[model samples]
Target: MLSFILRRLLSGVVLVVTISVIAFLLLYAGGGDIARRLLGEDASPATVAQKASELGLDQPLAVQFGTWASGVFQGDFGTSWFTSQPVSDAILSRLAVTLSLVLGATVLIAVVSVALGVLAATRRGWIDGLVQVVSLLGTAIPAFLIALGLVIVFAINLGWFKPTGFVQLTDSFSGWLSSITLPVIALSLGGIAGVSQQIRGSMLDALRQDYVRTLQSRGLNRRTVVMQHVLRNAAGPGLAVLGVHFVGLLGGAVIIEQIFAIPGMGQVAVTATSQGDIPLVMGLVIATAILVVILNLFVDLAQGWLNPKVRLS
Candidate 1:
């Protein structure tokens, strides 16, 4: 198991490096006057040229890439052209907001999705049918639309919560939670549907297995047969889907965040791209890619743990 984890960690390192290089090169390929764009209309041509040179824009492509990559390795994602702050620091400052929303939504979705799926699979009646319909509806609707609808109903019409702006949790927990609720709900809708579907399929398959039938024939109660035996077998698929979706929640909340006006990493990446903040955007991409790789590796480890026969070592 240790060896397997180490191997995956090595792979993750390679993946992050590859992703960072690609993101940096793609941002650089646009060949715009980054310094001029950052300086805006007030800067003269000579000033822009001087600033660009100072920023090392005149260096050869390979040299610039090496410099950027080295800085990244040293945990320096460069200074943001707009903010003149270290990219890492800028991103980390907003990390709490993004993590709070993502983690809260994830926990809620996992509980709701798993329960609905298990119930629906075990019952196979009206309860199951109703859940399936809801899941289907959820899948069909986009997150941004859900976010808008939620804001309209809960904030604009009902006046239950403020419609926009983010507050730090330490400053005011209630205010922070209120600001995050709509966005979390919006982001979780599609995930809920996806997880439910994956769980349902896996549970149904588990139920039809020979071991499940053996457990049923042994006079085990329905609850035990389903929860203990079936759920254990079914969890593999659900975990796989959950792993992929978990990574997505971090970077995929762009639309939902924008709609709810909650500042997060997704919002940061969007703003960075628009302003051509190459370093910030590239850093965000690298961070997101690394997250995905790590989650996937963890999923594999989990699978091996759940079924010892899989032999991770």
Candidate 2:
């Protein structure tokens, strides 16, 4: 297990570095001089040259990347081209908001998917049909459309939640929850749909296994057998599906954040990419890569824990 974890960590580090280098190169190669963009297209060539020199944009790609890589190791992500603020600071400021949304949505997905999936697997008729219908709708609809509809119905019409803006947790826990509710729901629906379907399928297979029948024949109650034996075995594949859904959630958060005007890493990523803020864009890419790696690591560990047969190495 330790070796497995170490291997995963090393791979994650390598992945982050590779992604960072690729992002840097892409931004570097992308046309439109950074200095000119900063100074305005109308700026004189001499002014652009001076700005580029000052910003180290005049340096060779290798030297510039070396400097940026060194700074990354030292916890400095360089300064944003437009804001002139440290990239780390800018990202850190919005990290909490994005984390809140993602984490909240994850919790909701876990609870809803497991409950619905288990119920659907155990029950018959209308309940199973309803779960299937929900799964179909969730899989069929795009997150942004769901978000828009939710905003129109719940926020604009019912006034159940604030349509946009975020409140920090430190300020008011209730306010934070309230502010994040719609966004979380929007982000979670598709994840819930995917995870529940996987769970339902896995559970059905587990229930049909010989071990489940053996457990039942031994006088274990249906619920106990299903919960203790079936769910555990079913969770492995469900977990793997959840990991994939999580990556999707991250991508969806970008669109949801924009629609809701929430201040988050997603919003920052959009702005940085659109404005050609290379440092900030690089920071976002590396940060997202790290997050994805970490989440997958957790999913791996969970699967290994839930099923002793899963060989981590």
What value of lDDT does candidate 2 attain over all alpha carbons?
0.91
* Residue 222 shift from truth in candidate 2, angstroms: 0.9
Tens digits of per-residue lDDT, candidate 2, 114-200, equal 999999999957999999999999989999999999999999999999999999999999999999999999999999999999999
Candidate lDDT values, in order? 0.84, 0.91
lDDT score for residue 11 of model 2: 87
lDDT of 1 by residue, 1-313 (tens): 8877888888888888788777777777575777888788899999998988988997877889999988887878898888888888878887787888888878878898899999889888998899989998888998878888988999999999888889899999898888888888888988899998899989999888898878778899889988887888888888888887887788657777777777788789888888888888888887778768877797888888878765445
Candidate 2 lowest-lDDT run of ten: 304-313
Question: After TM-score superposition, what is the CA distance of residue 48 in candidate 2 from its true location, in Å?
Answer: 1.5
Q: What is the TM-score of each candidate against the true structure?
A: 0.93, 0.96
